[model samples]
Target: MRRLDLPPVWLLLFALAVLVLSRLDPWSLRLEGAAVDLAAGLLIGGGALLVAVAVVQMRQARTAVLPRREAAHLVTNGVFGRSRNPIYLGFVMLLLGWVLRLGSAPALALVPLYAWVIERRFIRPEEEALARRFPQAFARYREATRRWL
Candidate 1:
């Protein structure tokens, strides 16, 4: 059997797990305000926008978007300028949005869990590779940008 090797695949798996758990919301916690709904909608939209911008920037730079591959260039402009791992940040935002939408306090735990998994599984390794590939530039970029914002 092939290994489930990609970060996105892992993210999707965790998301699915969160979805399943949300169905079993034990405390029955819920936010019953239009403002809460608005916040959730904003998070969903912003997360999607961040992911889209990151992908587009990667494509324009002719760099590999997947963390497993070597990047062709160090992307530090646009969304990349704001967060070193905008894609991963986007994923976290998406999870948060889902948790909010579901109104599940238990599901909120998955957001941090997803972040931990992505950081350990993908971001750290990718950063190591980038440091090796573009030592000076990567150092400067790392110093300038937050990992997640």
Candidate 2:
């Protein structure tokens, strides 16, 4: 794992960017009402649960949480069975919730960008390592579980 390649750090940067971009008056979508608030809350809460579950599984397996690091074993059950990168997926969900909460059309742009960056900078490399480390299992898992869901 690269010492400086932190997923959460990037999440914070993107979140701050969303907040800053949401302030631009010209591009405001200005979504309002209880529905928006409830949706945002659900997304945020679900994202946190995903992250928490993924982390707990990794820790229980005695594997490295950081990307591109050596893994003790392949995680293919629970939340991982749904997505190869649950933590990153959770991060994107959190970003989407922020976009909805901010109600800015322009802020929504960064949500996909965040996913793209994480996929390019972290997920791809981590997958490469996992493939090399656990070839058959990785292939099976990749086929069964999507990179993102």
Candidate 3:
């Protein structure tokens, strides 16, 4: 299949934006007591864990790598068994975790925008490529696992 045309620079830019948005807002939005802290911790920690898992899976696949520009294989095992786009999910979780940490409604404004760009620019084309490369297996995997958590 033809490789998707996403730029590595854009991914880096988006990541930087997420980091900045998570921390820069003046309003320190706090969640109510233990629940907020717990959820924030979960989102941050889970996001970190998912990133680690994705990294390990990338090493294993020696192919199904990131940025939609460097993909080499159609990975469908390990973390890929659970989520089709663990890296993207990790990123979203990280963003949400940041919003939780910031508790700033404005900071959260970035989440949906991020999701939209990711879904359109990264996810859709990747799905198309996967469908082309491993039509049968990809369909089966799609049936089994979710696109996101």
State which candidate has the highest TM-score. 2
Off by over 4 Å in 1: 1-3
lDDT of each: 0.85, 0.90, 0.74
Which residue ranges in model 2 land beyond 4 Å of their true spot? none
Residue lDDT tens for model 2, 9-86: 899999999888888758457878899889899889999999999999999999999876799999999999999999
Q: Could you tell me how far off, in angstroms, the CA of residue 71 lies in candidate 2 after the best superposition?
A: 0.8
Identify the superior model by lDDT, candidate 2 or candidate 3: 2
Candidate 3 lDDT, 1-149, residue by residue in tens: 23444433444565567567556756655345677778878988998899788889788778756555546777888888888989888878877776676565566677777778888888988898888878898899899989985
Q: How many clashes show up per model?
A: 0, 0, 2
Residue 28 C-alpha lDDT in model 3: 57
Question: What is the overall TM-score of model 3 with all chains considered together?
Answer: 0.76
Provide the lowest-lDDT 10-residue window in model 2.
Answer: 24-33
Candidate ranking (lDDT, best to worst): 2, 1, 3
| Best-matching candidate per lDDT | 2
lDDT (Cα, 0-100) at 128 in candidate 1: 97
